[model samples]
Target: MRQSRFEQAFLAYLCTMDVLITVVSWLASYFISSLAWSLDFYPQQGETPPFWWCLRTVPAVILVSLLSYRLSGLYQLGRRWPLWQEVFHVLKATGLMLLLLVATTFFARNPYESRLASVIFLALTSVGLVLGRRCWGIYFRLRRRWGLVDSKALIVGTGRLAKNLDVALRSNNWMAMEPMGFIDDGVHSSVGRATQTVGGIEDLPKLVEEHGINCVFVALPLSRYAATKKILRLLRDTLVEVRLIPDVPALTPLAVQIGELEGLPTLNLRSSPYSFLDGLLKRTVDVVFASLGLVVISPLMGLIALIVKLSDGGPIFYGQERMGLDGRKFLMLKFRSMRVNAETESGPVWASQGDQRRTRFGAFLRETSLDELPQLFNVLRGDMSLVGPRPERPYFINNFRESIPKYMLRHSVKAGITGWAQVNGWRGNTSLRKRIQYDLYYITNWSIWFDFRILFMTVRAMWDKHAY
Candidate 1:
């Protein structure tokens, strides 16, 4: 669809701002480098480039930056585009532009006026570009919230899916999508649902014309094959964007991927997180974090070990079999927080609040979650991840899998020392069903930043009520 005058004006403003920001960033980067190191501190005996001489490259840098952002799709960002993704693309474009600037200088047989200044410019501009785009996005979001222009949306079929989608769009005001109403023969009265019923599928085209619907969503059930086909055929003449909501509301899909299998479209429902590059990135982060954590906390861990060993002259470390990724069992290590035979007779019983089996120091360790420090080694050994679903014992897994739905799905990813469930107070004999829900949510929404947030929350929740 052709963009409106407002959208075109917005895009033009963004382009103009991009050029201005690039110029400012180039100068700012050079100024920062000057403050950090003397411009006369050159690697070779070439004349120190004066400010004007260095400024000559700013125009070229700005041109290349604009081209890079255009190629990176930064200019095509919409209101719905994720801020993180936009920032990432902006940073990538800035890096490319910097590389281009360096290459151009090298090709010209006159290396950068000042190598240090060039490096500083790249670092400064990369950060500035991302911040600039973020500010732009924030301004638009605020404007949209204050009754700016919004896309008119029409939802076909007034089923549960349609109602849910309506509620979601209406609740998230930042979405900037105004759902007009539903168009289904089943729903005649709209006393409680999303507004009044506009009309059935028969009146869809007229409604679109009269209501100025720019976006149409077909949310009818999959069972109504005839109705769905007829609706699509009717809407074919309209120039609106039509989207079909797949009728699979019962299944909870984690990391869904759409691909072609033998020339046929296939929707993967149960996609795992450890696929190719994602797996590599996750493992690489895990190893780096685990190595650093073990080094920094070694002294504290040693002290805990000493205390546990002296409490009863028993083993300092306890290793227990627990289920992990792909249902594989691994010996999870932790500081001993119980008597020698605390669970020998009872056999795999969950420790409760104020459990008498715990030693005095052990109780403190359990309360503070210091007992789980040894699992950092497990992360290093690749038996677990720094963040994932908390591993459960085989004894309880056997029971939960039989009783609870999707209980074993938590094992789809590597178990972790602390998980979304634990930080959210679902640890140590809490509701198993709720734990499974949070574990699955974490798996589906896994990202480096998400992992960092969970880690921060874990540290903040050190004295949590459910730690025991």
Candidate 2:
């Protein structure tokens, strides 16, 4: 079937609600700002613009808000986002809308130039949009429970992947997709006993017509390519919408993106998640925060350096070659946390608890993660990001890349002083597989908010027991 009527109606409703909220927020903000100014709360040179003059910008505000929300993926059809995630999306869209308004205000000859009013509009619109979406979600859930928005889906496989997808769909009942049953050429023993095979693949079109199936999900494995092609060809004659659930191997941690090159469809299996704008924003934050961090903690670093030197007269700063983005070698810096030549006899090895190689001050530094302070310079120098997969020594990387699947995928982004793995207690001698899993997760889900979260978690993880 085509896009569901419910989804279309919901989208239109959301757009209408957003437009109404924007206009109401603008008007409310104008009146509130005038009230504040008259009460001496907001001191200004003159009275605020007339109501009709402020109303002149309502259309612009609504247009910008809708465009921002659309760009933020708020209008994506059939999205079953959790309430909190939807609210966050609304907040982001509202923020972007305000930014666009401010940027255009610089060029537009509008008489309504009250910064206080703009601020009030931002707050009012954000709250209004979030509450509006939440209320709609609740109403949608009620409607879904009444079976008014249910969409019947048919699965085209009976394998483990198909069973997993069924479980996922059922667990997310908010999507209102009911799995009718499976259709496979032959039932496998691994198929879930609860969801039996409805019929062979030959019955697909008949089942679709009889059951009024709205969607068909093909969760076949790669080994069944021929059968999958046949199924697609059969689906072509039917009205049900088709969705392919590629059973990609676990080794590929990065998300798959569809690309077109010269009219040939391509699947980007190995790709950096960052867009150019995302990279620029991340780099800007890295440089600004790294610089401020270095300056703020320079004195403490100096004191640590003095202690390390006075303890054993070793180098104050330790620099080691580590692999970073795209497997490039960079000198990662740290305050000296071990005696000179501590690893000479043993060769490069991971630090262990109660290790004899650490000096008295070095042990304290390592325990508290003070040794990682110098890596802020690495961030400033563009050798790493403020948050990402922790860089590993070349000796370890060479072996890990050979034996561990998708280990090199972590290098898709810059190494970080503190990372998702580190903050999640996967640092030091923790499970390499779990650390790699978290690292890949960070890369695929990289966002400014995610970076800030990791940084905050890193502070709380300073005394993590996993640290040596």
Q: Give the best candidate by lDDT.
A: 2
lDDT of 2 by residue, 51-146 (tens): 887878877887888889898887775446666677788788888998998777667976667889888998898889888877876775677568
Whole-model lDDT values for every prediction: 0.78, 0.84
lDDT of 1 by residue, 1-468 (tens): 255544567678778877887788678766666655554453435444567756777677767887888876676633344667666666778778877877876786554466676667666766776777667657756765676646788888777788877776665443456788888876677822446677888888888889788888887776764687788788889987777777664565466666887988887777786668778988999999999988999899888888888888999999999999999999999899989988978778888898888889989998898998999899989999988999989998888899999887788889988789988988887898898889988988787677888999999888878766
| TM-score on alpha carbons, each prediction | 0.79, 0.91
Residue 447 of candidate 2: its Cα lDDT? 76
Clashing pairs in model 1, backbone N/Cα/C closer than 3 A: none
Which whole-number lDDT from 0 to 100 does residue 303 have in model 1?
Answer: 88
State residue 181's C-alpha deviation in candidate 1, in Å: 2.4
Residue clash pairs of candidate 2: 1-239, 1-240, 1-241
With candidate 2 superimposed using the best TM-score fit, by how many Å does residue 257's alpha carbon deviate from the native?
A: 2.3
